[model samples]
Target: MNSNFDDFVKQNVELLDQHIDELFDSDSTLNTDLKMMMKYSIDAGGKRVRPLVLLAILKAFGKTPNYDILTVAAALEAVHTYSLIHDDLPAMDNDDLRRGRPTSHKKFGEAEAILAGDALLTVAFQWISSTNLKDRIKSELVLSLASDAGASGMIAGQLLDIQGNQRHYSLAELKHLHHLKTGKMLLFPAEAALIMKPSKLQVAELVKDFMANFGLAFQIHDDIIDVTESTAILGKTAGKDVDLNKNTYVNLLGLSGAKEELNQVLQKCEQDLTSLGELQPEMDLMILEGFLTYLK
Candidate 1:
């Protein structure tokens, strides 16, 4: 699954790269500074996970891939990158590195970094709105993206994390935080795809369960990576979460306990996928394999 996922990711990266360049070229009056900053942040390179998830979901549904799909996928990635930019600000995570490069705030000034993040966030909507998709699909995509990234979702989780400094939380409280901070964003790709498909309630519910469990497992794996991997391997400052006094699965649950939780969540996700009769076996395998790869 890891090898196949990596290959899929590589292909999607190439597609997104072409589309992004085209997007820039098509807009001549785009503010040069903002464009540069946005491009830098987007191109700075991560796993491109959100867009890949979007594409995978669309493929799983056997939908005909179109320009609208790519546009929405890219927009999702834009929103994600914007969040990282703001999250690394001195006022937030106060990080100096991301993806092995200087963080936005480190390379550009704090003010520019803030503006860059703002631009990316707003432009994400612009990208979706300008798409040739149906108005209904466009509206749904916008609403999902806004809700997931807004105060009630990722931002709220971030606030909780900031306030959790030097404070320990119960497992339930920690799971709530993870759901808000990490899980919501992760769930959006799958949810957004379902929105595009307009599936039955049962199928929608299955996708929701699968994504929710996958998101939790992913965050747990991230916690493990923070403690087990080096900066060189992680492509960012290692052990920063511990330095920030942030609560993590690793701190709340022992390593063994966290791994146990991850396994349990993965099993639940797999079970949910199995319940969706129309879902392809390859897609199920892909999602399951992808989750397993994250554990590495």
Candidate 2:
């Protein structure tokens, strides 16, 4: 990644931290345990990629940053955090660590962890609905998010994951599951940002294609990490997929093949970005590439 991207990432991350702190800091007065649990879940320090990507998309269109933008982006992060909380449950992946800290269930117990996820999910919609953005813009984003997070999207992907454990899926099947699970969330930000700047509609098609490829590439990189990195490096239970005998890019395509596939996706995303032909093309590419710095 370039220094420019590093700076961009730093500024956005700092702003995102403030937004999160202010938003959740108010909830601390509600119920001490639930508030602390909320803080624990959000404050555990993940990448904050979902919100960052939303802002990046908006910046690419030269849209001025606003509190409303941050508010909506925070909504997406809440949904993502909720997903992680539930994913670590005993009934799910049963993970014990996340971002190098104890998983929510381990730290807060299953009942509280479950409520925390519910709270986070509801908070996401509340943020969006209460935002002062135009009603049409707000509704579009909420509807897009609903499809991505609900039964037809990530939830369905989770169902496939649980059922496919210890089972092999063809390449096509794997991509289908991932498109639902990870790809839709990535696309949601792009779609929502375009609504804020309808003039970018001409470029929206290319952005969609870029996000789809990038999302799959991101997951493949994750699979590679599980196989190659340590638990300490991953900040989560590494190689758990192998221990669980789960299907993954590495299992289906050898390590070398997975890397090759990742390269293809990156190349495709680059092509889509270049086709955008706008002032922010370089920034757009940098934003995408910076996320994959682990590959370097």
Candidate 3:
């Protein structure tokens, strides 16, 4: 399943590589400079995890996938990439490298990087709005994306994170921070899939549970990786959290305890999947394993 996911991402990368320029060209209203900046960040490579998650959820529902699916997937990815670009700016995580290349700010100057992130974020919504999907699905997708990516979600989480950097947080506070910063966006893919098929309420609830737990687990694993992984392996600088004195799961709970929490979250996600009873147990297991493997 991991191999299949990787292969799928590779294929999607090729498709994105082909269509990215065309996507910009199709919209003449987009300012040329902003379009170029947006494209610059969008073209910068990453794992394409958010889009892959959307595609996986669609596949899990037995939907007949099409180019429209890829378009929406790409939009979600654009939003995520925009966040990364902004997050790496001097005002945020202050990173110099991303995906093993100079960050947007480092490569394009701070002003361009800021504008690029803004353009990518706005273009994400533009792509969604212009998609030929049903009005209801498009509305739901836009709403879900906005809710997760907006101030009350990722932005809120980010604020707490910056604040938490200078202070220690209890487990509850840490969870709140992560739920906003990371978990909400993770939940968006599953929720967006539900929007694509509104009748699947049971499946949607199951997916929501699965995504919530999985998202938390993913964040916990990220904290672990930040402590253990090197820049070469992580494709970005490690130990930044430590340098910033950020409060992380590892810092609060200790490495062993943090790993145990991750396992528990994974276990909960598996339990939710089992309760769903519609999905293949093997597939669920594969996803769980893939999540762990990718984090490691």
Candidate 4:
């Protein structure tokens, strides 16, 4: 929410873009079409929120990255972008646009889009493997990434989400679903950061809570935006959930109720950050505040 946090995120985006270009080379040994598709989707505008938050949290803990943070961040962005590519497929959300342009499948054809996503997913681990951190730390990050982005996490949440269409979900059920589908990837930053720089147990717990609540708040904001924003403003199809008859916080809780829940989560997120008092807390708290504020 703060100007400082905004600057931090903006700077991180620049870093992420640079790293992606280097890591996902357009002139590599891969087929030209596949490379073009991959580059197109990756360069498609995204917030790079995951890596920024991860870097912020690590800085909060009075630690610098164990390796080139931008490269590591790019790895996560690859995963996130890959998810978007798959999500926009005709078999998935059937989206026609993303980041203000044609969806990968729409731009490159479905088969090429699919391969592009696959390449990005594989490249995520490849980037991680290429990192200079210790083997244990590298393994921890890779394993956490797999767990968060894989079947037991985002994939499972997506399955639950698809099945949840046409069915009513209690607030608890909705939270659980988003926790997996959206929260895990969002939480990955703080989780991976904690592993990189082992903070005190209490700090670790607070960080988990903060990231979890932030993740939920972020998703709720998205649900609200889908209902309230125009497709042009969203740079992606808006109200696709409604079109698909999918369950969402806005539908279940009503817009006001959803906003209320978001505030509660945000208050808790702020409180968690508050507990980390002093000891170079200003920058970290500012980043978190900016992260949350930017959501609105």
Candidate 5:
């Protein structure tokens, strides 16, 4: 990754950490154990990809990062963290580690981890609504987040993923599954940023197209990493996908094929970004481009 992205990521992550930490402090009604588990997972290391992507998209459109942006970013991260906590449960992917630490369930007991996930998911909306942004903007963000993280989105993807163990899915079917499971959250950043800047609504579809390809490329990269990286490097159990018999790009397409597909998807991302640049010359796409390059 480029130095610019590295610096942006470091700065934003610290800011987000502060914002998320403050959320619990202001709430007098949070249970101690529940708060501990939530903080455990939230403070547990993650790349904060969703928040970074959302902030990056807003930056591309000339919106400076501020407390309000941090609030929205924190909300996005909350939902993502909740998903990770739940996804690692015994009933789900049954992971034992995440981001190089004991999985939430492993560290906090199954019931506590479950409640922690529940708390994070529910409070994410509260964070959004509590933001100082206009009500319309806040509502739009909440709606986008809900639809993306809800039953028809990531949940559907998870359901399909579990069921995929029973049968081989066509490539198209796999894409559809991931488009919900992974793509929608990635897509939400772009959509949310566009919502914030109605002036750039004309390129909404173009931006969504870019994020769609980016999201798939991300998942493909993850599949490749699962096979190539070690448990230590991945910060999670390596080859778990294979152990779980989950459907993945690497399984459906050979390693070389998956790499080839990743390249193709990234190339599409570049094309989409270029089209956006053509429409809005002032938009800084270097950070966005760096994201694609980093995935490669």
Candidate 6:
């Protein structure tokens, strides 16, 4: 990533932390234990990647970060964090660590962690609703987020992922599982930004295409990382997928093949981003393009 893109990411991460603190951490009305659990996971370190994606899309379309935009981004982070909390539950991946600390369940107990996840997920829409954006825009964002994070999207992908433990998946099946599981959330940022700022039909199509490929690349990178990185580096158990016999790109296509596929997907992402930049010549797409390099 270029210095400008790195700077943009740093600025947004700081802004997101402040916004999330205002929205959740500083709130005093909630029950003490539940609030503590939620805040613990929220404060748990993460790069705020989903929120950054939303902010990057906003910037790509020439929209400056505002109260409404930051709130929306924070809401997106809330949902992402909620997913992680739930994913670490005993019934799910049963992870004991996240973001270099104890997982929510381990730190707060299973029941509290579940409620915390639920609270964060529900409150995310509340955050969106409270935004100063127009009612229609708010509605669109809520609807998009709900669909993307709910049973039809991420949850469905998760179900398939668990089921993968029992069965072998072809490469196409694996891609489909992740497209719903991981792709939808990644795609949501671009979709939400376009909703906020209506672009030309051509530009909208290109943005969606760019995010679609970007999402795939991200998932492949994650699968590769799980095998190659350590628990300390990943902040989660390494090779857990292989241990659980979960289907992944590495298992199906081998490490080299998965890397090749990631490169191909990233190349497609670059092409889509290139077309989008040309279509909207006034916008600097460097930040959006910078995301691809991270996967590589």
Cα-based lDDT for every prediction: 0.83, 0.83, 0.80, 0.83, 0.89, 0.89
Poorly placed runs, candidate 4 (over 4 Å): 64-67, 278-283
* Residue lDDT tens for model 1, 1-296: 46777776778788987787777668898999899999999988777777877787777777635678888888988888998999899888888989999999899899999999999999899999999988988898999999998998988888888878858888999999989999889899888989888777877788788788878988999998898899989988999877766799988887888889888888887788677744544444464346456654
lDDT of 3 by residue, 1-296 (tens): 46965665677667765666678888888888777777777777777667777766766666635767777877888888888999999988899988888898998899989888888888788888888999988988899899999998998998998888677999999999999999988899888878886645666688888888878988999899988999987878998777777899998898999999988888887688677654544333344335445654
Name the 10 consecutive residues with the lowest summed lDDT in model 3: 280-289
Tens digit of lDDT per residue, candidate 6, span 1-296? 49998999888889888888887655667787877787788878897878898888888878889988989988888888899999889999999999899999898789889899999998899899998899999999999999999899999999999888789999899999999999999989988999899998999889889888888999999999999999999999899988877899988999999999999999899899778777778887899888887898
Estimate the overall C-alpha local distance difference test score of candidate 2: 0.83
lDDT of 5 by residue, 46-111 (tens): 888888988899898889888888888888888989999998999988899999999998998999
Model 3, position 102, has a per-residue lDDT of 88
lDDT of 4 by residue, 26-133 (tens): 436767777778789888887778888888887776665444566677788889989999988998888899999999989889998898999989988888888788
Residue range 84-149, candidate 2, lDDT tens digits? 999999999999999999999999899999999998898888888888999998898889899988
Candidate 6 clashing pairs?
none
- Report lDDT (Cα) of residue 252, candidate 5: 87
Give model 6 RMSD, 1 decimal.
1.1
Of candidate 1, the 10-residue stretch with the lowest lDDT total is: 280-289
TM-score of each: 0.94, 0.94, 0.91, 0.94, 0.97, 0.97
User: Distance from true position, residue 158, model 6, in Å?
Assistant: 0.7
C-alpha RMSD for every candidate: 1.9, 1.9, 2.4, 2.0, 1.2, 1.1
Better of 1 and 6 by lDDT: 6
